[model samples]
Target: MTALLSRPGRVAAAFSPAHIGRAATLALHDELALAPKPGLVSFEDTGSHDDMDAHTFMRSLLALRSYFTHMAELGAAFAPFDALERSGIEAEARMLAATGGINTHRGAIFMLGLLCAAAGATQADGLALSADHWRAALQQHWGAALQARCARASVLSGGRAARQYGLRSASEEAALGLPVLFECAVPAWRAAQARGLSGQRLQLQVFFQIMAELDDCNIAHRGGLEGLAFARTEAQRFLMNGGATRTEALTDAREIHAAFVARRLSPGGCADTLSAVCLLHRLGALG
Candidate 1:
């Protein structure tokens, strides 16, 4: 709710690399703190996986604390795509070491890291910290590289599933400036705030919206195409039934969580997208 830099002010100094990096880290925390996230790990429970818990996420967060800030600094300098990619690769190595080889935030490391860089680049250009400016900076700086990257074969499970199912890979989403994050998730967050919603309820609504829209490779990798479809349908159904406004909303969400865990369907992409929403919120871009 506090914005150090917004459209009217455009305070470049306020959008420092450390500030952006801290925001990105806190955004990941915000995402991790959300409970009943439907097959994702949380403080109250590990929704699906036996391999990870909240402590693992905490270690990952600790490892990634400075990565985003560094990325932002690189972006402010107008560094090339290869530089950002190298930074990300190094950060991923730290994350893996921290989590003891568990992939706690691989998707977020790529997505949010880019956005953090884009935000810094936008600030360097004297642009407002609005979603549009950040996204444009991303496209202007690394759009072509991301597009080219999408064409390469990926050995990662999520990427392989995306390729096999003909779904849009994360690289494709990045090349196109993360349409779901900007077009869908950000708007949904604003709409929820406009509806007198706040706190976890607000986050839940936005999370469901992203889940309903994203072709989550994690879900596909675990549950295949059918699992992906099921997750989306369930998310849509949650939203249709009054979303977080329902009197029994938490109970309903928990039920959905149980179902997803039973099938091992974690909508990791949606979780990453929600973290992006949190980053924008922290940056004062949502207002």
Candidate 2:
């Protein structure tokens, strides 16, 4: 495996631009390939989204390939937060264009974009590209800026929901170094892997773990606080009942999917975190 980080002077040769790009692409693929995801898109169904399907996700992913690579390159060059945000804006525009204005990967663009940049910074600073390295780099580089950004009122659905519900916005999550991803999602994923899980089973286990803990604004935006609570409770129940290890897991997940769709609820924030976990795993950062 190619290390995403190396000694400062040897950064360029440690990881190729294409390698960073592939990491992002593969992470998106892993998210999409996870089937029976409650209220989320998959190869088998559209989940909660009426405007997008697996193909729509593919188009959005194609549009973002260059964006992820560019963000990594910028990070490697020690670019500022404004530069990364600018690149993300351009990437978001392309994604919207590709999906006919549907917001398929906006959250992924922000979360994974930062991760990619942090990966680049870690390599540039001559550190190992571990999860801690990425977290430290993000805090050192853009933590204050992200906190400031969260102070402003959000015009987006998720942000607005966060404010209205008094829940943590994605900006706040980023500002806090994505505690949900590092402290919750990744550890659960690694434990599942250690237990010999893989593929969709592994993904579903991680997804439910995220859903159970995160105050997912998408769920709030669509379903309100009551819906968010209900969703969280259901997710907690799923995990308490043994998650993917149980024979009833798939049936239970499908039931939740049906319920969420009926209420127009989507745990998009959890989905985004899952993608980040997948990326970190791919880059060998989770360990």
Report the backbone clash tally of model 1. 0
lDDT of each: 0.92, 0.89
* Best candidate (score: TM-score): 1
165-271 per-residue lDDT for model 1 (tens digits): 99998988999999999999999998999999999999999999999999899999999999999999999999999999888989999999999999998989999
User: Could you give candidate 2's per-residue lDDT for residues 218-247 as a string of tens digits?
Assistant: 999998999999999999999999999888
C-alpha TM-scores of all predictions: 0.96, 0.95
True-structure RMSD for candidate 2: 2.0
lDDT of 2 at 4: 44
Clashes of each: 0, 0
Q: What is the lDDT of residue 160 in candidate 1?
A: 94
